[model samples]
Target: MGFIDQLKTEYRVGGIVQRLIFWNIGLFIIPMILFSILKLGSVDIGIFDWTNPFSDDFFSLSSNPVDLLWKPWSVLGYAFLHSGFMHVLFNMLTLYFAGRLFLTFFTQKQLFGLYVLSAIFAGLVYILGYNLLPLLVGQTAKMTGASAAIMAILVATAVYAPYYEVRLMLIGTVKLWHIALVFIVLDLIYAPLDNSGGHIAHLAGDLFGFIYIKLLQSGSDLTKGVSGTIDFFANLFKSRKSAPFKKVHRNTTPPVRNSAVKPKDVTQKQIDEILDKISQSGYDSLTKEEKDFLFKVSK
Candidate 1:
């Protein structure tokens, strides 16, 4: 299949992780391309430069709390943006790995909710740290990237399955917590060196991830609120599709059923059976024909 068609198919079936990745990548790329074209055409757009997401006042989170009053969406919007190529690349790669690990132990809704909530939490922490910390006094900074959300997923997964092992390229297999510790330590070490605000945000994400899992274990699902809010808004904007018009035909003769006749089309009962099998044994357990039938029905 062509790239766009393949993307569409994958998006339809790939669940929330893929959707999140698509969103981050789209948010980063589309604006860059659009603004580059506009710049080439000699069109001057003031202040909000798409080339540098960090410089964009409208979306990227600022160190000042007062900025939040004006750009409240930045709490979550910043997580979907990146300042540069490497910024987005490593973030997305980590997200793919961490998000998959998280999904193995949690629902898609929980993963998504944790991501959004953690990003907001981290943004708030970033603002608070900049204002309250004596060392950060009189310093102004802006932050952007999915690193905060990605860190939350990574740390949350590790906290839940500390012993889970995964193989690395240069390095051998290591425990999930080992990986989480390494990243957390790096953030701590760099918090005072460079990109301090970003590092602070990462640490906040790590903290939220740990707290999120603890609360979840105690039977308090923090993700439910985020999921419910998203669902309500989704339902609010969702358009109701009308059924297509069909012509009615009357036949004088009655149809006859033959024992020798073979059915060429799939039935609702067959679809339900396949769906039940999927729910019981997972999508990978489906046979080739079953997979094809399901895909066709989805289309």
Candidate 2:
């Protein structure tokens, strides 16, 4: 397949990690492509420079309360943006693997909820930390990149499956919590250094992830609202995609079938086993029969 076609195929069939990576990479690439075209023409767009995503007034947080109030979408927009290549690279890499790990223990909807909501939550915390903390009040702290969101996935996976072992090259086996704790401690230790605002935001994301899992374990799922909001928008767009059927006055009752009814032999035990398989491997690892069973159960 051609490059673009391959990308389309992957996006259509790939997991959430692939889609998230596509968005981040796509956003980063667009600005660079624009810059290249402008550079070839030896032209400067000045105020019309859409290439500079960070320079946009909307690409801000509580560092400037007035600006943030005016551009509220910045909270979410900032996560998809990056000020540098290394920045986007690290965040996307972390997200790609962390998402896979997160999905092993939680639903895809839950992962999506954490990724988006954690970024917003982290941004808010960054703002609060900037505004409330006397030491950070005078400093300029403009946040961007997907670090906070990646951190959330990292922490969520660690918390959900603390003892889950991964056999690393040479290192043999290591627990998920061990890796997660190292990152958390490093952030905490480096909070007083330069880029403290970012470290603070990362810490906030870690906190949110742990709390989210804890609440989930306690029967208080924090992701339900986010999941519902996502479904609402998804269905809204899906509704627009389908051609409407003309209403007929003489229409009879809709056909019914045994499809709505489940076989008595397909017990909850079977479902639990399928779910366990998903947790150990992934949804993509499910057989065709398993996939069909899941689809029917979902319906």
Candidate 3:
């Protein structure tokens, strides 16, 4: 296969978190590259000028309802745009680490659901905070970046592995929930100082992540429909690749019924793989289903 085809095959098998990171990076870079080419080539269209924040064509969700209505897609688009190199770097890194930690205990579908739902929630929170807060009344700001989504993933990981210890550079070993508490407190403390709208969005994402997991532990899977949504969109765009139909000859006589076979025991290879994942991450990283499977086989 060609390199592009190989890459596509890999992407098809890669989990949702990996796909999200790739999409975020691609979205962040492609706009600027396209705009730069248009500028260098002396394209004088008014749309090229709209790439700036001062223009309405910018991909940022604004605090004003009128501005939001003009470009409704910005609510989701803004989450993939980055203000600076360091901002994107930090956000992507947090997503990579936190996503890995979160996926250990949650399905890829759940991760996708939480990331998207939290972004939409954060955008609304950002708009409401800017428009309704007494000190910030009548103020408007353009919001961009994946910080809110990253915060949701980070807090989710910490909640799932509250007592799990992780060793950090200069910090030695610290409990996951302690780290989450520190972030929550810091965001609250700084909300009044600077970037208040952004902080509010972060807090909103944190709230959503916490609630998502809490409900999930109670046997509610918020992501149950996420896969259906994805499949619907994918099928809409995918080319027809169905296998050729075949007709089979039918037997004249009825076949005798056979007894139902009992399932085989769990294999050593499967247990080893689960054990390896636990060793690399932690016990709290195991999903409830995984825990149940382990319990059943341990006896």
Best candidate (score: TM-score): 1
Candidate 3 local lDDT, residue 169: 88
lDDT of 3 by residue, 1-299 (tens): 47775555344435567678778777767766777778779876574442542234457888887777778998878887776667778888888878887887777777888888889989998888988898778887878888888788778878777998878789899898887888789999999899998999999989988887888789987777776788787776653565456678999989876555334423555556666666445455688987787656555
lDDT of 1 by residue, 1-299 (tens): 47786676566557678889999888888888888888889887777675774557787898888998999998888999888889888888999999999989998889889999999999999999999888898999888998988999999999999999999999999999999999999999999999899999999999999999999999999999998998887766653453357688998989886766445433656766876675445566689998998788666
Looking at model 2, residue 3 earns an lDDT score of: 77
Q: How many Å off is the CA of 281 in candidate 1?
A: 13
How many clashing pairs per prediction, in order?
A: 0, 0, 0
Q: Rank the candidates by TM-score, best first.
A: 1, 2, 3
> Model 2, 192-249: lDDT tens per residue?
8778889999999999999888888899988899978877998899899987996668
Clashing residue pairs found in predicted model 2: none
* Predictions: Cα RMSD each: 5.1, 8.3, 9.4
The 0-to-1 C-alpha lDDT of every candidate, in the order given, reads 0.86, 0.81, 0.76
| Candidate 3: residue 254 lDDT (0-100) | 97
Lowest lDDT 10-mer window, candidate 1? 260-269
Q: Which ten residues in a row have the lowest lDDT in candidate 3?
A: 48-57
Question: What is the TM-score of candidate 3?
Answer: 0.74
